[model samples]
Target: MTTARRGRPGYDLESLLQVAVKLFNERGYDGTSMEDLSRKLGITKSAIYHHVPSKEELLRLSVDRALDGLFEVAASTEQLDGRAIDRLEHLVRGSVLVLADRLPFVTLLLRVRGNTKVERSALARRREFDRLVTDLVKQAEAEGDVRPDIDPAVAARLLFGTVNSLIEWYRPRRGSSGAELADAVCKMAFDGLRA
Candidate 1:
């Protein structure tokens, strides 16, 4: 059974999060005030407060949603049995899906500048995620699936850089799909970038 927020009467947490994420991306996190959020949602400021304690909580929730999707991919990859290269491909494709599904939130996450304590904390968590992926890249190199000449750190950065850049070019369309993009990414990354 699901329950709605007490006394809110209509808006639920998920809907509130969607509105909050869109506003956060459009206005920039620091630029957005709680009053601004309430105005955009066409609700009272206190109603907004009823769902989320503060603007910062909204930011934290949005980023956590994106991060949770990403870290789930990494954990699932670790569980699957295969060569490190195969697992790497799984990670890449899963990450693409995460970006596609949570595009707005992840976009906000990647653009964070560490200007506030919340942003700094998000940056630190993002770095930890990067480091975990870097280790996977290193494992792939040891298995001779990746080029030895290129630094694993550099390769990791480049791979994520390309994936992260998808938020810029990838507009969801009716014809082209995320799986198609993920397949292309895997092929391009492994066939072209591999040793």
Candidate 2:
């Protein structure tokens, strides 16, 4: 009998993604396989596949969830107006919170190796996100809201680099939810990093 055939109930889509993210980080995306995932979840491979078409689909969905919140913040009314500095602050704060809320998924998105077609697509979307933010940074510099010494492209990457790094050490505390962690991220990224 298959391992999953004898185990407890299989996890739902969200639960599966959470497990997959953890495994992707632990084993490296290239190292993990459907069998490994099924074994880990104690569910049949078919059961896993039923929830997600393929491992690539799981990766795509996970990355999209992380990116959606970010894109929303970029397009928000608060981001469209105000001093370039304020808009940049909103972007940074919103990004930090989104990253915190979706840390595992975002971390997985950042670690994509392009070993699969799905990863390459995710990489492309990530570049688009960077491009949008870079434009904002450039506008901020033009408005004297940010230090002009730094290149906007470089600044955008640096800001995201700092915020995304939260996944490396951040964990939800006993009383904190992912949203709370996101709030903390916003405070540190904008208020703390600004000149």
Candidate 3:
């Protein structure tokens, strides 16, 4: 006969989500299974389900966490009230900080291939975020803070492409901080684009 099992102490939805996101990052979202999660967590599959109904729900939650951080930066007063170039710098800095702080989630967000409804939704939000940054680039160009030769959309794409690529290789070191990296990115990007 199977013994009655008690829930693990201190194990909650947030903790479960953390493990799920980490596993999803280490193993591709499509590659991980509930059994894998249960094995990693040392819990029964039913216990995993107690926190979230399905693996897809966990994916949605993980990508949403990354998207929420990006949206928060986009909605900040610094991003909205500053000169366009300053605002763009703030957005870039905020994005670097978010990626550093939430590397696993952001990495997963960047890797989503839109195979599922949640992935498609995440992709849509990413596109919307890109459009908002593109608008800032256009405004900066009009104000003569940024060079006019390149199209605003193209500039925005290149800027974000560089920033997003950080996840591939960035590992936090003892003295280095997100703000320092952000400063470097702004300096490099603006040095090239500033008029």
Clashes of each: 0, 0, 0
Could you give me the TM-score of model 2 versus the true structure?
Answer: 0.85
In order, the Cα lDDT scores of the candidates are 0.87, 0.79, 0.89
- Residue pairs with backbone overlap in model 3: none
- Model 2: clashing residue pairs? none
Ranking under TM-score, best-scoring first? 3, 1, 2
* lDDT by residue (tens digit), candidate 2, 49-71: 88989998887888788878888
TM-score of 3: 0.91
Across 1-195, the per-residue lDDT of candidate 1 in tens digits comes to 022233444678899899889988888888888878767766777877778888888888999888999999989998999888888889999999899889998999998999878889999989998997899899999999898999999999988998999999898889988899998888888788555
TM-score of each: 0.91, 0.85, 0.91
Better of 1 and 2 by lDDT: 1
lDDT (C-alpha) at residue 108 in model 1: 91
